[model samples]
Structures are given as structure tokens and as C-alpha cells.
Target chain A: GAGVSQSPRYKVAKRGQDVALRCDPISGHVSLFWYQQALGQGPEFLTYFQNEAQLDKSGLPSDRFFAERPEGSVSTLKIQRTQQEDSAVYLCASSFDRSSYEQYFGPGTRLTVT
Target chain B: AQSVTQLDSHVSVSEGTPVLLRCNYSSSYSPSLFWYVQHPNKGLQLLLKYTSAATLVKGINGFEAEFKKSETSFHLTKPSAHMSDAAEYFCVVRGPYSGGYNKLIFGAGTRLAVHP
Candidate 1:
């Protein structure tokens, strides 16, 4: 019984560079979510996916942020032109379905933009 | 817009002492409230949830929370604090339903320190 998993536990990037973060949701989990946690702040919702569709992206900070889940099991969050403000921990979560309230989280990827 | 407030930014207690982390929330409708804990460099773990079914909710590791609609609060408590309980705690509320799903709104978080 594996939980949600994310790649690139830590990443350092130069300003204006592009970065992609990956998330592997638990098996059979049809609902996935992404969140961003800034230093000393609570995590904020970034986007959500149900199956292969991107249902919500209202919390995405800017046009540079894009996410995709082509096969529904794995998702990726891509940020173009990395900026200092983009430095934060990116978390991924998954649940059995859209109605499930409990969400299992991944360890998260910490992105540092210099 | 729904929101949550963790009253204390930090709480320090001696081991075996009672622990209390206060939270307040505002929402347009009856909300789903939750408590999550995050250890250093670890993923967030659910402590408990109150979905309007019962006012008092019990969760893992001897944690519990009481939801009081009159006070607009969902405060987490433990009879006795443990050294392992030293970590960050978050109060959360489910956002407005949309497109068959809802997102989670998190409070700024309360860091607990347990000293023996």
C-alpha cells in the first residue's frame, strides 16, 4: 500500500529557467491535487484533477504554471521562467475518489529559485 | 470565501501536560473541518475531521478535536502532550463545492514544542 510520491525532493534553479515537478498518486486514486507551501505559511491549493481531466486551476499563481495528467495516474506541474517568488514546496495528494475527504500526501518537492 | 484561523502561531508545553491548539473558521455553509500534522521534512498527516456529523471527533495518536458552531471553532486537544507531538499543526476547511469537488483551505499553522 504505497502512498502518493513526488520526484526531485529538492531542486535549485536559476531565474528564468523552467522546471517540472512530478507526482505519482496512489493506485486506483481517481482524484489528485497539487498545493504550494511558502516558507512559514500554510499550503495553498494550486490545482486539482479527477481522472484525466484538469478540473480546477484557480489557485495557480500565474500563466507560467501549467499542470497535466495525461494518463490519470501521474501528474506534473510545470513552471516556466522560475522566479524568486516561485520558491516553495510543492505537494501532491490523492484520494480514492472525488468524494473522498481523506487525502494522502507526498513528501513534496522543494524548489529554490536563485 | 471560506477561511480558517489558527489562533496561536506557536504553543509550548511540558511533556505530560495538556495540549490545546485553537482554530476558528468562517464559511458560507456548514463546513468540513480537519486537523493535519506535519513533521519536519514529512508529508502532512491527518489527525481528525469533523464533517457536521458529530461535534467531537477523535483521530490518530490520541488526538481529538471538538467543533463548536456557536463559537465558529474547531480546536485540537490532547489530554497529555508527548515529545513526539512537537511539530506543525494545521486547521483546514473544505472550500465551496464546485464541479463535483472541493478544495481545502488551510490555516497559517501552529507550531507545537514539547519539552520534558
Candidate 2:
């Protein structure tokens, strides 16, 4: 009955540092996704995970962005050498199956790169 | 590629008045449409969805949306809006070209305000 959850609801990082955001998908959810939204902009796709497999990463802005879903249930989005432009609300969502097109979103991690 | 467009950046209405939030979508194939609402400091919540099942889809909190293929629209509406309806609304679309994943493309959200 629990919904998707993200950790460090707010994170502040200095430029050139590294930061990792965590997502805990709903119980038994097989599909996971990550999104980023800048001020006054809609959310943009970042990556997707089917179980433990990283299916799509095309939306990742640069090589500095990396994601992993090692055990298929939890995921992490890591940004290396964080830049000021990376500041935004990082959202995570999960669905039950491939056909479960409706995704349940988390509170989102508000990341600030100073 | 699939995309969504929100017609308005903001919508305001008095309590008990009809609510309308317009949205347009683009997809190469039959699209699956959805409406999501987000309260400040909270997660996004699904209001309703329209697959191939019906032209008009009803969702929670007395909200509904009509899917018009010809107009490329899936606008959300309610017979009477409550003060609590004030929030940010998003229109999303999932096209048929997904490679085993449901990539929901979202529109610029519309901020709704309700007045007493």
C-alpha cells in the first residue's frame, strides 16, 4: 500500500562535487523511472529501469549522470562533478508492470548545486 | 516522438464553478493519455487516464477527461471545483513506439487556483 519514495527530500551540493539521489519504488513495482524538472519547466525524462536492468539512459544530459538499479527494487541517480545547471527537482516514479502506464510519483528530491 | 502541450499556464475559478484544464498531445500512434495533479511539497497523483477503452474517462475526486482524437486533446474538467482543487496539473501522453517501457511525456503544468 505504500507509494514510491525518494530520500534526502532536499540536497545542497557545491559545484564540482558529487551527489547521489535515492529512490525506493513501491513494493513489487517492476518499472521505475527518473525525471528532472527545472524552474518553470516541465519534467524531462532522465532514465528508466525495468527491474534491475537499466533500459534507457538516452535522456541523461551528459556522461556525468549515472544510474543503477542493482537489486531491481531500489535505484540511485548519481551526478558526478555536479554543476549549477544540474539544480532542479529530481523525481522518481514506479509502476506495477509494463502495462501499468500510470506512474506513481514520489515527493521528489530538490537538489541545489551552489 | 510524443509530446504534450498545456493550453494555459494558469486557470482560476470560484468554488462550485465548472473547472477546465485544456491539454493537447502529439503522437505517431494511438496515445494513452493521463492527468496528474501535484500539491506543493507533495508527490504527483493521478487524476485519471484514457486508454483505448472509452472516449470519456472518469477519475478520482470527481474529475474527468474526454479524449478527442480529432482535436488531439484530452482536456480535464469537473462539474464543480472545490477549493482544494487548487494545485498544479499535468497532462501526459504515452505513445505506441515505446520499446517495452511506458515513457510518459508531460506538458508544462497548469496552475489552478480556486476562490471562495
Candidate 3:
């Protein structure tokens, strides 16, 4: 079976530009999450989705950040007017269900804001 | 709030020597702890998890961790270090359950280096 996968792998954006990262969770996974990893730092929670509903977005740093999982399978994290501080590796993870403690992660998309 | 602290920023060991990565956690209630490893340019991989089951948890690649409530620690250990084990390791704790799901809080991480 396939694991979680993310697209772009790497992205370079100018300040104030918008960028979108995609995540494809494993087949049958019902819960998804997004995290951000800064250089030399551990990953921090960003948002979470249960099926098609965005359950928690409290970890999202600012209003410019948005996420959607309309179909309950694939998800996308979008940043509006990206800033230099937003430069980091965007990670996506998924679990089999809401109660499952284990999360499988994607390779992540490294965004560089210049 | 739940959090984890990795006591050491880095650890270097010779191949075939013991490996120890220390982790301490803070939580309001009984916690679920985990150790994850990350290779360069790769995704985080779960090495082991302690979910209030057995106190000593075993994981893949000959790695294991013991959950000690009294010490507030869940340290990872392996009898012998391998060169392939060189990577960044993170100590994680499951956050308070919210709306039927839980997020993860990670420690700063410990970089392990193995020399032959």
C-alpha cells in the first residue's frame, strides 16, 4: 500500500507571493494533519482535518494560512502573501482513523521565501 | 498542554556501542509517548510508541523505550549502535484529545551520529 505523499518537494517563492502545497494521504486514511518545521527546529502543528471537515486550525500561525480537504482524501495547505518567516518544510501526516495514535508522514515540501 | 524535552542536542557513539536518547515529557494526564527518527531529506518515521500498555515498548530496528511515570521520561535505547542509526530523533507526546482527535507535540530533537 502507498504511504502519504506530498507534491512540489521544494518550492521557492518571493515575499508577498502565495504558495500552495498538496498532500495525498494513504488510501483509507480518514484523518489528516499539517505541520511546519523550521530550520534546526522540530515540527510544529499547523492544522488538522477529519474527513472533509477542518476540525482544528488553531495552530495555524496567521490568517494568511488556509487548508482544505473537501473530499476527505486529499488536502492542500495554502499560504497567502508568504513571508520570509514562512520559509520551512511543510509536512503532512495521516492516520487510519480519528482514534489511531500512529501517523504516517509525507516527505514534505520545503518552501523557501526569498 | 503536553510537551516534550530532549535533554541532549546531539549524541555521538561508535558502531556496536550502546545508544541512548533521553526524553522528558510534561502532561496533565496519562500520556502517549513516542520516538521518531528522521533521515536527511526523508519523512519522520515512528520508531516506537508507549500508549499505557507495557512499560517497556519495543520498536523496529532493534530500538526500544521504557516509559517511566515517576521520572516523567520515555528514553530510547538500543544495545548496539549502527551507522544507519545516525539521524535526528524526536521525542513526541500526544496532545489533549480535542473533538475526537489529538495533535502531536515534539521535542527539539537529538542528532545522533554513529562513527565506525
Specify the highest-DockQ model's number. Answer: 3
| CA RMSD of each candidate after superposition | 0.6, 1.1, 0.6
Considering only the true interface residues, what is the Cα RMSD of candidate 1 after superposition?
Answer: 0.6
TM-score of chain A of each: 0.99, 0.98, 0.99
Residue A20 of model 3: what lDDT?
93
Q: Alpha-carbon error at B64 in model 3, in Å?
A: 0.7
Which docking class does model 2 fall in?
A: medium
Model 3: per-residue lDDT, tens digit, A1-114? 889999999999999999999999999999999999998889999999999999999999999999999999999999999999999999999999999989999999999999
Question: Between the candidate structures 1 and 2, which one is better when assessed by TM-score?
Answer: 1
DockQ for model 3 equals: 0.86
Tens-place lDDT per residue, model 1, A6-60, is 9999999999999999999999999999999999999999999999999999999
lDDT of 2 by residue, A6-36 (tens): 9999999999999999999999999999999
The 0-to-1 C-alpha lDDT of every candidate, in the order given, reads 0.96, 0.92, 0.97
Worst ten-residue run, lDDT, model 2 chain B? B95-104
How does each model score on TM-score? 0.99, 0.97, 0.99
**Which stretches of candidate 3 lie above 4 Å from their native place?**
none
Question: B1-23, model 3: which lDDT tens digit per residue?
Answer: 79999999999999999999999
lDDT of 2 by residue, B64-102 (tens): 999999999999999999999999999998745466987
